[model samples]
Target: MRTLPTPPLCGEPATVRIELYTADSLDACAYTCTGHVIHVTAVVARAGMDAHPVGMAPDVDRPCGYVHVFPTGTLADEPAELSHPRWCDRDECQRRDQHRSRARRVDTNRPEAFIVDVALVQALHPAAEPMVRLTSVQGGAAASLVLSVGQTRVLRYRLANLLDLAGARPNGGRWT
Candidate 1:
């Protein structure tokens, strides 16, 4: 039998702030429970060795976790006519396209951003810093929530600072 992350207390659900970066639309409503598996797979692949799967979806019989994804638009999926010289600078268009191509080389068919519930992730991993793998379904391109040791340091430092605040402290600790 597999172990799962303990669910949050009955009335005390936490909120995780997530930022999804993409080339186009930032529609938050696009994320749905249906894409959970694909998104989880992408996250696992991109996160590499450190991350593991957990939780369950009430509606789906298959294993599920807290990570819910919303689609962040990608330039590769955008219409070509939008980039035509009529609306924008030709030079800028070339530069944007070049950058998009480089990103495509890494993750060709997937959305640029993977929207997830960080609070649930935290509930699952507890002490461990969570990381995710963002990749295309075809394995053409990929990115990670954490890219380097330097990034880890920065993230840890920032989290620590956030935790240091009075309201952020767990269990109603006294203000310092």
Candidate 2:
């Protein structure tokens, strides 16, 4: 099992709505916040699917960006990840498909490839407050999202559950 920093959260629901569908700035820059270098990757996701639900037994073979925080570092440190999971292999993709009935071609750069900071997201109490500072390195407009309390709770639950399954402690940092 591994350890992680406490996530930043509002602890309660917010009174207003905060929508992050658009980017704030178009500056091509990167910044470090809370000891971590926050930046966007080449990956881009759909409107609301940037962060999807995690399975109880997540595919360990999959890249979740967890490796980035470890002593060994992130997928950027592992060249092999760029090829493995055979994103373009139609056969492999069909075999792993949950529907199992469709043999569709694999698209690696899809929404699933992006990384979501589970702990950081889970700690957010949108009902208590809206607006989160988001930083992306990839060339794109900076964006922010305002989630409803219901949406916030659902995401928090799923992410927290994943952390619990991984034996990763949450809220062990200054934000707690």
Best candidate per TM-score, number?
Answer: 2
**Per-residue alpha-carbon lDDT of candidate 2 for residues 67-100, written as tens digits (9 for 90 to 100):** 1232222111232322222223323322232111
Alpha-carbon local distance difference test for all models: 0.32, 0.29
Question: What C-alpha RMSD separates each model from the true structure?
Answer: 23.8, 26.3
lDDT of 1 by residue, 1-176 (tens): 11222222222222222222333333121122333434533543353312233343345332223323342223123333433322222344333332111122342244545432211111111243333223333344533342344565687788788877635644455332
Give candidate 2 misplaced runs (Cα > 4 Å): 1-141, 170-176
Top candidate when judged by lDDT against the true structure: 1
Off by over 4 Å in 1: 1-72, 83-88, 94-176
Candidate 1 residue-wise lDDT at 28? 21
